[model samples]
Target: MMITEALRLQSQGSKHLHFLIDVNDEQIIYSNQSFINQFSDIKNPAALLPYIENEDLKYVMEKYLACKSGEKVEDFESRVYIDGKRHVYKIAAALLIISTGQHIVGCDAEDITDLKDYINVLNEHNKKKNSILNIVSHDLMGPIGIIQSLSGLLNDPEKKTDEQRLYQYIDLINRTSKKCIALIRNFINQEFLESSGVSVVKKKSN
Candidate 1:
């Protein structure tokens, strides 16, 4: 199928599909009803040209101009807002030479806003999960190590009956228990910092 025919068919199916065709060195074409209605003050494509000074459109037009000179242009993705709602679009363009030998650029755009939003949500969820894992690991380490050390000392045959060794083991257990308490306190402080959107930083004094 011809590129123009395919573009027309797509415009008919998707109400949000917008276009701008450079015709006869003087006119621009658009298939989106919302665009036409919202920018009615521009009256025609010529007047609308000045308002479409966005970076994405500028890049697209530059590539389209290059394609007219027999250079191949690849598809690109960009975000646009129409009627206050953000839309992510993938744009593809091709150059066509008519029977009159006039070169025209045919562009097609597809909306992918929903897919981009879903991916953003997944990314946020992963970040929160990682933060929680870090907090949990830090909190659990001291207690688990103390339990391991205490169990080892209690299981030692020779040290089990020695009073001095038993007292030393008790001192170690006490120190480890204090460490576990400190870990819990640190976890609480971290939680407060996170809730307040504040980060923990080391102080450097001159």
Candidate 2:
């Protein structure tokens, strides 16, 4: 016996939210226990539109319509509200033809809220690291340029005519070097504090 797409997907994962909709009347003909429990006896897919995030509603609706029109939809992520709490789902849909030659749209949605949250945390960490690198690069250039100019003067005999002037140049270079050190230390400290606030743990393995 050949298994239909809807049946195959339904058998694949028990935790997934699975449903089948009649393409003609757009009625939800079949729904798994998980879907009925989460959505509470919704008549059709359109009934769940209000629970989808506003920003994602348009895109999700487009995909839904495409599935209804017999188009295969790739996996897409969207945030939805279930029981007044936000959840992320990776959704996919495909056209299913029954033995009677009737067309149906098979949809499978997986809960991926935890995975999305983890990815977001990693992205935020990368943004913070990039910000620190940009600031350190911009802030250190000025002091480093000053030190280079002063060191060039000390190396040239023509620019070192007077002892007092030479000593002043050396002092300025010292102060500029200290400023660079302070800038580095301050940024390092801030980065350390920010990294400490993250939930990630560093483990060293030999």
Candidate 3:
């Protein structure tokens, strides 16, 4: 009754899946409909490796064998291709005993494709935020440094530069100060755009 109730609950949840495998044969004894639907071509359970992406196959099999051998195995998280699309699954396996006194391995698989995609989006946003901060920091320092240097030159007690050079320094300072104001405005606009809008990759031009 408990097993039936659990299987019913799994179907109701929709995102979760459960599987029972024969420990000695590695054949699937039972699986929720969701899991069976994913591998509709299954002639045998061992064909399972074909559905898993190549990179994840070895690790997944290793962990499954560990569970069968009664050794500690870390939970396996891997990607599988289903219906021509990639999906992520979090899997955990353990030993189980059926009413017929058969020892089997039970695996719980949960689809996490949506969660992974959401996390990727958040990571991109973080990158954009960091990019804006970096640009503002570097841009602000450049103009401020120019003004400080020019002011020091003008205040020199031994100011020996020609009158024309002094005028040139004053012009440079004016231009730098104006540019600094523009930089501040850009920072504000970039912040607003990035925080509430889609993350855009800003390319720097020389």
lDDT of 2: 0.83
Model 1, position 7: C-alpha lDDT score: 65
lDDT per residue for candidate 2 within 176-201, as digits (tens), equals: 89999999899989888878756553
- Candidate with better lDDT, 2 vs 3: 2
Q: Residue 51 in candidate 1 has what lDDT?
A: 39
Root-mean-square deviation per candidate = 10.2, 4.1, 5.7
Clashes of 2: 0
Candidate 2 stretches with Cα past 4 Å from truth are: 1-13, 193-206
**lDDT accuracy of residue 6 in candidate 3:** 93
Alpha-carbon error at 181 in model 3, in Å?
Answer: 2.8
Worst 10 residues of 2 by lDDT: 197-206
**Ranked candidates (TM-score, high to low):** 2, 3, 1
TM-score quality measure for candidate 3: 0.80
Write candidate 3's Cα lDDT for 13-79 as tens digits: 5656777788767678777767767775353567888779999988888887788877654456899
Model 1 global lDDT (CA atoms, 0 to 1): 0.62
Q: Cα deviation in Å at residue 165, candidate 1?
A: 10
What TM-score, over all chains together, does every model reach?
A: 0.57, 0.81, 0.80
